[model samples]
Structures are given as structure tokens and as C-alpha cells.
Target: MANNPNENEQAQIIHWADMTADRIIKQKGDKGQYVLASGITPSGVVHFGNFRETITVDFVARALRARGKKVRFIFSWDDYDTFRKIPANMPKQEELKKYLFQPIVDTPDPFERDESYAAHHEKNYEAQLEKVGIEVEAIYQAKKYRKGDYKEQIKLALTKRQAIVDILNKYRAEPLEDSWMPLNIYCSKCNRDKTDHIKWDGQWEISYTCELCGHQGSENLQTTSRAKLPWRVDWPMRWVFEGVDFEPGGKDHSSDGGSYTTAQEIVKEVFGGTPPVYLQYDFVSIKGRGGKMSSSKGDLVTVNDVLNIYEPEMVRWIFASYKSNVDFAISFDLDVIKTYEDFDRQERLAYGLEEGNDKKVAMAKRVIELSQIGPMPTVCPFQPSFRHLCNVLQINDGDIKKTRVFYAKDIKNERDERRFQERSRCALHWLKNEAPDEFKFTLNRTRPALDLTKAQTDFLNNLHAFLEKEWDNLKSDKELHEKLYEVIHSVPEFEPMMGFTTLYQILISREKGPKLASFILAIGKERVLGLLRP
Candidate 1:
């Protein structure tokens, strides 16, 4: 087995999501009619980790469509599920405690913006999902349940309750009790599903007593809207009900005897439907956050926060460019600049402006294609390195126009202009919040803090004279940079770094700074000469 991807890899390396989609198409046998489904409980603030699920389905759906297979990408909000816990950020905790056992869709929105608590959260993330270019049919589980859309499925689940219990027992160490029902019934009087005791009144009505409030009521399984299947039964029921062809889940659900396993069996045996193809994706953790995120806790890096930092394309690239099962950390510090650089490098390779292996080029191209949230310019926008942009902004003291003029010599059109401005804003934010100490530097104004030797002084004077003569005809920063290298090598006593050190001491009274040539160019030739000359 080859350990490296580029080594001994074939001409075309299939992307993991594409491969999964392909298998789904072949198994389902309807290339033109396939549904890819993913859902999240709108129980709290949507976190960045939730994006893994959204983007996973989005990529696979896009890949399927790219192959001329029609796909209906559906994102379901499981809001009909009972509100089990109080979120950390929710206001009116005492007021909300009474509504805990009811469906989130029934609970009033604490913010009073939307119709219900679930609608409030769903509407927020719905806008965010649109921003990231996820074109999916957003389904609210409460509406579907209340409208009796899952009436047949609910009835079927009730009939096959014994079979579901048997299936769940296979994945559990201890057997389920004889009284365990696959469905939960809310009390008709209290509208709360946290009922401990339930009695089947044969065929249609089921009586339940709410454990939380001790409210007792009976509901007709045929006409009443007080029943919901538990997650283990509900998951597979939905898979069969919606005809889901493909879905991906986190590592925990993919573990042995996890909920997915139990659901798989229920779908196969009880629902009499083949389970959708499963892709087990890894978790995304923040650098300082100790473990995986639970959005309800409210300590999270939201998807919108990440979008504010990274371009939409680069944000999509983070997931599309990697294998699903490989765990990755999202660092907020200096690594963000490196991450942007990596994305740009891969993009260049994909566009054939840079050299890479055939398989790598193909993979890169596909990653970029899927990474886009919307159409991009035909010619890639010229971008200075993110690190360079950061330092140049600081050097210019956040004068965006001055920094842009210094960094980008040719702004082709509005697109290039817009891209440059956007990148500058992102870089400025990163520097202000997440940049590490090593990358931070301030240009010295008043000098004379250096103990320069006679030889170093002579070298600085000579380099100054050299720059005065050659700076004008020097077309670019690259040309000036090369010229600096030539001048240093001509004096065999000085090393490459020593040349930079000499320049830094004279100009900024520091040991090091930005690339000498670019820094000098950005500072303007006249300003640099004034500082360097005696």
C-alpha cells in the first residue's frame, strides 16, 4: 500500500465524497432522481462543526450533479424533537424551565423574533447556509409532524414497535424491557413528551402521564398529534420515508453499536428499506477548545465567524480538500495566513499556472471547483501573500489604499479591486485578534539604538549607494530583491541574513523586518534613502 497520495497514485484520484456519491447512484439505480439528506437539531446556536455536516452533504450532492445526476439536497431541522435541556445562553431560564418537556417548535422564542424557539434558530442558520451557497430544501420537522406528513410512517413504526425493540437490543449489552415503546407520546393536557408511563389502549388511543408536571391525558394514535418516534426509530423511519440515498455522520454515530448502527438495522428489518450509504466524517475542533463542540453550550466558533475571516471559496476548500475521516484543527492564530497560502497554492496548481503531478492537478481542480460558493473570475485575482499583506498593513498603519498601492502594482478591474479590499480587511482582523507575537513587528521611527561595527557601517553605506544608482530602473520588488542578493554575494564577508540585518539596523534599529527589498519599495525610495544616508 502506498503511504503517500502523489507517490504511485494513478492518473486520477477519486475524491472521497465523489466516490461515495458514485456508489450511491449505482446502488439506488436512479442517477437522475436521488436525494441526499442531512439534519441538525436546532436546539442552540449553530457552530462551525455543524458546517462539516452541511458541507459534506453539499459536496457529495454537487459531485453527483456534476456527473449529470440530478440531486435534491435537503437539510432538515429536527426541531420537533422535545426540548430536553436549557441552552447556556437562553434568557428567562426560570420561565423556560416549565416549557422544557415540550417540542422546541411549540416553545415560544425567547428572543420573540420568530414564531417559536426552533424557528428563531432555524431562520438564523438558514441565512448563513445560503451565504455559503448551500441550495437545499430546508424542512422543519415540527411542520412535517404536525401536518401529519409522517402519519403513515408513524403508524408503521407503531405497528412494528416490537421489531424496533428487537433491533435496538442487538446493539445494546442489556436487553430492553418488555414495556419499552419505540415511540414517545406527549400528554394531551400538558403538551409535554417527557412522559414516563404510557398505556396502549389498543389500535388507536394511547394514554400517557407527563413525568415532569404529572399531567395525564390520552391521544388517538390515528388522529392526535402528540406522538413522536424516538431517535433510534425516527432516523431510519425518515431514511425510508424520504427515500434518502446518501448521508454522512460524525465519528461517534459511526462507532460500533452507535445510534447509526441501530438505525441501520431498523431501516432494513422494520422499514423494509435499504439504508442509505454512510460516510463517517471526523470532528473539527478549535485550537483552544479542549473537545468537540456541542452548540448548546454556546462556546463556539460559528460558521459566520469563520466566513468573516476566510473567503467563501477557501472556507469550502478546507473541507473539500481533505479526506472526511481525517481529524483537523482550526487554528485562529498565525496558521490562518499559512492556510490561506496553501489554498492559493493549490488553486494555482489547479489552474496550471504551477507544476504538480497529474493526479494532484486533477484533485486540486476538483477541490477548487467544489470549493466555490458562487461563480469566480476567469483569471485568478492577483493576491499578495497573506503574511506580506499583514506586515504591509501594519507598516502602512492600516491605510488600505496606501497598502494596496504598495502591494498590488496592477489592479485589473473591479473584481481585482474588490478582492484586494476584502483580503485586506480579513488580514487586518487576523492581525488584530489572532496573530502570534513572532509575526508582529513595529517599524522604528527614531533610530541610533544600534552598536554597529566599522565593517557593518561600510557595508550599509555601500548598499545605500548601490540602491541609489539601481533603484529607478528596477521594475519590480523581485528585481530589487535579486539585486540585493547580488550585492551581498559580491562582498564575500557577509552572509545572506547579515545583509538583511545590516539594512534592518540602519533603517529600523531592529535585527529583522519584512523582506528588505519589498519593505524598502513600500516605504518609498525617497523615504528609505533619507533614513539610510548619513
Candidate 2:
């Protein structure tokens, strides 16, 4: 990730989304609308790791629309996939364990909320997506399969089983058995995919014996939902079925022997549809936690988790800021302050409110264009200092109302006020939960009695007098800072560092803390005078 926020304008900037859209337009030719596709199996919670895939598609869809192309975003929920393992995060682990090998849509919700376990995760994530401004024509695989919407495709996969096997064999190090079929089935009796001895007639009927319950049954592909195609075959089949112009895959599927490679050949050779233009995306890791997260392991963060700490636009910025192939971490650590600062700087440069390298400014325009949750506001959005907000929120003891009042004058419009309120919530949440210990503290109710050095005591007396006399005249942090510096330097041989250290110790009982000037103003001059009184 060679992402330099301060990259010089002479640097050539090529946004990945624009490149992908261009490739699709060139490869597929312009049509009335482009169908962009993404999907995942709802076997476990759809954590933030999985979000990289969908948000990648969302970015390209936005880019395509930016190029005057109509775009339809389709997100398929592969709910008909089997419940290979229960997620560690879900409730009722023992209750869920029994449903293993069953289609996820057939498994009952352990929470007993939605009709099925798959629906529980699916619906929750859908709501989370809307918060981040992603809308999709959701395709539920279970319903489509049950309604026989893919009847002709199902028969086609069966008819082309040998060709599908040959395509898959090209990627397998060891050869697949000649009898391997391109399909899978849940037993009619047991409703589990623990079936063996699968045989498909030359026509529409398929028979399989349940290895679990020992029941042998045959069902017509036209009428039964028990049969489904394997992943490699199913993916390309749907690409043709939906006329997808562009789709993106994770690194796993983009490798030489991966699903996307084989599916490209299979779609052309077996189903006779051209594969969609594809981009290979990398994984997103949680900061300080190495490696990709697993929903099955229940150690992953969700979109909701990210949204808890980030404003909606900030969430959009995290993904849009980087190319899909670039691996990045979502930090909940001190790096969070830098993340907010970076976003603010980009927003400033994009609105021409600040100057920057030409390349970065150009990149900021498109990136922020994609980052927005609504239409681009004519004026720049609010760019509050997240670090300052953290300090102010602590001064107000996490009371958002009081915190909002403190920044009320800085805000000029309803949008800025809304931003203040939202970012205040994020700042407060960070301070309470994710911030470093030194970054968090409340104002001392009463002054602390410390054995002060004569030099430190002399500086504090001067500082106290300066605040008392000039507090009412100090209009901004910068002005207050300059006047306070005069008081410290005026004392003979009093080091500026010593004066700052004494002030911090007297205020927060620490040698280091937030930017001093604004922090004092945020604390109010009268309160500082009370604390400085010896």
C-alpha cells in the first residue's frame, strides 16, 4: 500500500474503479445498463472482511455511472449453500451444530427471529448496508432455487457435467473422478447434503441416496429444490443468467487455479456465456490483529462495528480511499486520529478549501465523490478536528448535548451541525472505548495540591494572572496560545517545556495531553483559574 496522502501533483493518479469501469465498457460494449454482480454464502455472519467484495462492486458501479453508463448492482445471497459450520458468534451453538450439512435456508434460526438462520444474518446486514448508502437488488438463492427459476440452467449443468468436470480438472493438482457431476443435492428425506451415489438421468430426473439416513430417492430437476450446481459451475452460470458486465473476486478466486479462472473457461465452453470483466481484491485486516478475519471463527468485525466508530461518509471513505487490490487495516487504535485527520484533509483539498499536490487533489475529487452518502454538497462538508472533539467530549464528560453547545458556534449550517453531532458521537465512543489511556480524562473537580518547584510555581502564578486578565479577550485558541507563550517566556530562565509540563500536570495530572491552547479554552478560562489557584 504505497498510499501517500501528500503525494505531489506530478504523480500520476489512476483510480482503480475508473480503470475497471473502462475495461468493462470496452470489453462488453455500451448497453442500456450494466449489471454488476457480487455474492457470498450466508453460512456465517457477513463480517467486514466480506464487505470488501461488495463495496468494491459498489465503487465500480459508481464509476460506471460517473461515465454516463446506467448500472444495476446485484448482490446474490447464496443462502442455498450448506451450513458447513456454525459461527462461533451466533447464539445457541449446540442448537446450531445439529443443522450442519443442511442448506442454510433450511436451518432454523437459533435466535428464533427470522424464518431461517440465513435470513437472520442476511436481514441484519441489509440494514447495515443501507446505513452506508449501498443499495442492491438482493437475489436470494434459496427462493430462486425453490421456484425453479434456474430450471433450464440446472438441466444444462447436468447435461454438461463431463465438460464441467474437465474444466475443473485443469485446475486440480490431482484428477477428479470421471463420475464427478457438476451438481449437489440435499437428500429428500434427511434434508442434509450427506448424500452419495448421485446419478442423473439423461433427462431431468436426478437420484441420490442419503448417507446419513440411508434413504434413496430420485427427484425431477423441474420440480424439486434439492438439486443445485456446484460453486464453480454455478457462479459463471449466473453471470450469464444475469448478464453481468463486471464482477470482482477476492485474491483466493483470482489465483491461477482459482474459481474465477476455471469459471471463465466453463462459461464459454459449457454454458456459452462470456465471463464478466473481473478485478482481484485483497483482504482487509483489523489493525494490530494480523491476518484476515473469519466469520466462522467469530473473530471478525462487521460493518455495524465499523459504523459504530465512523460516520457514514467516513465508512465510505475507508473503502474508497484505497484501491480494491490494496490491503488495508481498519484501526481502532491511536491510528484512528490519523484516519480522521486524513479524511478531513482530503475533504478540504477536494472542496478547494486547502491546497495540495495536483495528483492528490484530483484523486480526492473522485474518492470523495464515491465516499459521499448523498448528492455532492456545493460547499465543502464540515471538517472538524477529531482530536479536538475527543478533548472537548472528555471536557463535557461524554454529554453530547453539552459537547454540541461547545462547538455550536464553529458550525455554520445545518449540515455542519449534523456533522458535529455525528462526529461528536464517534469521538465520544472512541474516547470511552478505543482511545489510548493518555488521550482520555475528565476535568478535575477540585485543584490538586502538588509540591511545586519555585520556577514551576512562578510560571503557574503568571499563567493564572494572564488567564484572569485576558480570558474574556481571548477569542480563539491561536490567539490564546500566543498570549500564554508570552507569559511563560517573560519569566527569567523558565524553559517553555517546563511551563507546558507544569500546566499539563496541574490540569490532567499527566506530563502530556491534548494540544494545550484549545484544551484550556475548551476547559473554560474560569475553570483553569480555579485549578491554578494555590
Candidate 3:
């Protein structure tokens, strides 16, 4: 185990786990066993922001395993926390309002069928992790850990409680407002914890009445205890109790001189134990949408929402492309298409399908393989923008006509079938949202009566004659536009620009759209001359 490995040193570090394991071994010697942990309070729908912590931990855990290190990754649900105010979107707010101060584990599952509310939220997030290939042993705090699994550690802190209290009191006295209560106990009666304060009076202490519920009784903090250690002590206490080696958390806990730092001190002081190695991850910011994706705010985009537009591999690539410190953005717009294009290009370079001058190609290839996509395509040449694909699909009635025809005609290109399928789904979603009206062509029943004045009639006749004669010779869109403008300019009877506009409107309106010159040729010179005969 050594200090942080350089890029040159990175090559020597073959697997991510080996790099992490080496670091752990350096810190704790050969006896160090690596473990990963991510904890969440199931206060709302588990949004993508919450999932970031899970994925971050999973990446490290997988990397450790790749390095031939034994890794145990566990997730803890903070279900024992009292239910706060009912979230706004909750269907039955009034009914559940009564359970606000009780442990979430004791509340009935909002969905009714689930065993408990905590279980319902836990299952929802667990399902998402499974979908994203994130694996972890789940530890439910309310059930397993809180039922005296950590009783010895809890009692140790309780006996040495004065020391913990002194630290908190000292913190509170400081001008920086760094202090917090050492214990958070929910009264079995009024159920509120924050508003109530406890005062120790020798062997016996009197409990104050809750201002809201007005329920009061005499109680003992040292005896008949139903409280957990405060967050600062609880965090490090868990590390000591579980013998955890590594864990990642949001900046709130991991910030400079924050709870994590303070907890490290308490762990060594009260428990006489070493704390785990900590990686502080920053928040992922979404584009166009201000602020982080939050479950409580109900402003979150779920993992399922993202999977609709992108392949799982591409989504993972988006995460792996950046280091944890940088804040990033994800959009469901044309930008998503650009991301896919970038992923495809990188995938090609990695597999030697495309010539590239950079050694990063090997790293890209490693990511591609890790993401589990098959070998790169050999003959598939076209890579359209997501917006372009959407437009094409829209014009083809969501049929993806060009891709389907290409695949059908090229039997040898069958190796790229899966790539086409994945892209087609992305195209379908773009078409559905962005260009629904143009996805399919349909004809109208009746044509509008053309009531042109004498000058307008003559211009139409001249335009028809010009198109019929030069239709076959026309080569490009620019050429066709120039030809149409020439007719409009020479014929004083038509307002040149208006003539081109009218012709375009008529063609699209009549034929559901027509090839510029071909439709003029099809309608014929004699019919055009007669229709314009004012």
C-alpha cells in the first residue's frame, strides 16, 4: 500500500480494487478487510440524487473486487428516524400526519399492502439498485441494527456519555453554532423530539410536556432508554461497531470540519476505535432544472425515466466519464443524443474499429467491456444525431424506415443489429415527444378552391412550365430554390417570394408533401395552364 498512485503508477495498479486495497493495507496493514457502506433515510421516493451515493459506493466496491480484494458492501436504511411532516405529494396526508414523531418502521406502508411504510420505500429503492446492477447487503437499522445489534457499543457510549455531552456542550458554546444534542429520543407519548429538552437532575429527571401534544411525564434518560446516539457520534460509532473500512457520503457530512471530522475525534475518544476511510462526493446538478434532484421536493427524475432514453451502459458511461468532485448535468433533450454519439465513438476507438492517436482508447475500451455491450459493429457507418433520428422517424411514421431498410438489405451487417435496436428505441422516444405530427404522412380529402386574380394565375402557369421542363435536370436543393426564385423574379404577375411560399404551401398541403419539381411535372402543364386561366 502506498500514497495516492500517479497515472504512471496507475498502470502498475491493474485493478481498481487493488488500488483501494493497497491503500487500505497501507493504512491498516495486511489485516485490513475492505467494506463499503451507503446509508439513506427513506423519507421520500428514492430519487436519482440518492442513487448517486449508492452507485458511487458500488463502483468502488466493484473496483476493489477487480483488484483481488475481499469486499463487503452493505446499505443501511435509517428507518428508525421519526417520520417528519407528511410529504406534499403523499396521497393520504391527514391520515399519516399522526405518525410524524413515531419511527417510520412503525408506520403502516402508505400503499397498505406492504408490511410497513419503511419496507415499501426500501423495496422501491432496492428494485432500482438491482436494475442498475448495484449489489449490496441491506441492513435495516430499525429491525436488525437497532434491536441491540450494536448494544455493547451503545452502552459504552452511554457509560462514557458525560464525555460525549461535554464535547457537544463545548461545541454549542462556540460562536460558530457547531453544537448538537448527543442523543435524539422520541417520547412514546407526544412523539416529538426536537421541541422537547431534557434536564438531568441526579438519579431522576422529569420529562417536560410537548407543546404540541401537551403530554408530559417523569422519565429517565439512563434507564428505560429508547434513544439513539446523535448523528455526530452515531456515524463513527457505526464505523467502529461494524468494522467498516470505507464509506462515501454527501458533502454535508464530509465537508471541511463537518460531522465526519468531529465524529472521527469522538470515535477515538469515546469508543477508542479508528474511523473508516471516507470519500466525499459532490451533488449531481441537472441542466435547465435548478438545484439537485430531490425526493422530498418531488423534483426528481427517477432511474426508470432516464432508462427510457438511454441504454444502461451509456448512463454508466456518463457517470464514469467524470470524477466525483465535478458537478455534472444530464438532459433528456438533443443533448442525450450527443452523449450517445460520444459513447459510440469512444466504443469504436476502444475496440480498434476506428483509428485514434490516444492511449485513452484502451481505457474507453475497458469501460465499454465493463458496461457489458457486445463487440463494436463492423459495417455500420452512419451515426445520426438523436434529433435527426427523431426527425427521420417522425417523417417515417415512427417506422425508422431508413435503419430498417439498411438492416434488411445488408445481411453481413447483422452483427450490428443490437446497436440498431438500442438506437431505435431512443429514436422512438424523441419522435413521440418532439415531432409527433410529422411522424406519418396522411392525405386530405378535399382540396381548397383556388381563387387567384389574373396576375397570380399567369405566374402559376409560368412556374408550372419551368418546373416541367427542368425537373429532371435539377440536382440539389440550392439549385431548385434558385430555379423557383428565377421564375418568381422574371414573372411580374407573381410576388416572387410569395409565389415560392404559395407553391410550397400548396404542394405540402395537397400531396401530404411532394418532391418539389416532380409534383409540378406530375400535375402537368395543360392542367396548370387551365387552373390559372383567370
TM-score for each model: 0.90, 0.95, 0.72
Best by lDDT: 2
Give per-residue lDDT, candidate 2, residue 340. Answer: 94
lDDT of 1 by residue, 1-534 (tens): 124657447424788878887789788886567989999998877788888988999999988888888888888899989888888888878887888878988888899899988898888888988877888898888878777777778778778888888878888889988877777877777778878667775477677778867888877776777788898888998998889999899987988889999888899878899899888999887663356677666577787777767776777899998889888987676678779889889988878888897778888888888887767567776766787788788777877988887756667877678768878888887777777765666665555556776656666677779879878888988988988888777775778788788788776667777788878877777777777775
Residue-level lDDT tens digits of model 2 in 286-320: 88444668765767788988887889999999999
Q: What count of clashes does model 2 give?
A: 2
lDDT of each: 0.80, 0.86, 0.63
Candidate number with the higher TM-score (1 or 2): 2
In model 3, the Cα lDDT at residue 381 comes to 34
What are the runs in model 2 whose C-alpha is more than 4 Å off?
1-11, 289-291
Separately for all candidates shown, the number of backbone clashes (residues 3 or more apart, or on different chains) is 0, 2, 5
- Weakest ten-residue segment in model 3 by summed lDDT: 439-448
Write one digit per residue (lDDT tens) for candidate 3, span 1-534: 235656785574243323455566677565535777889988767777776788777767766665666778889898877787676666677778878877788778877868888888889888877766777899888765346565556566666666776665554545323233355566657655653554434343435445566666555544534566666778788887778888877887776567777787788889988877776777876653456776667566667666667766666666666566666887665466567778878777766677775446656655664454343344443444454445344334467554465345433454445446666786686545533354333222233366656665566677667656765686754676677777777766567656754554443343234444433433444443344333
Error of 2 at 393 (Å): 0.5
Candidate 1, residue 501: the lDDT equals 87
Listed per candidate, the RMSD to the true structure in angstroms reads 3.7, 3.2, 7.7
Candidate 3 positional error at 499, Å: 15
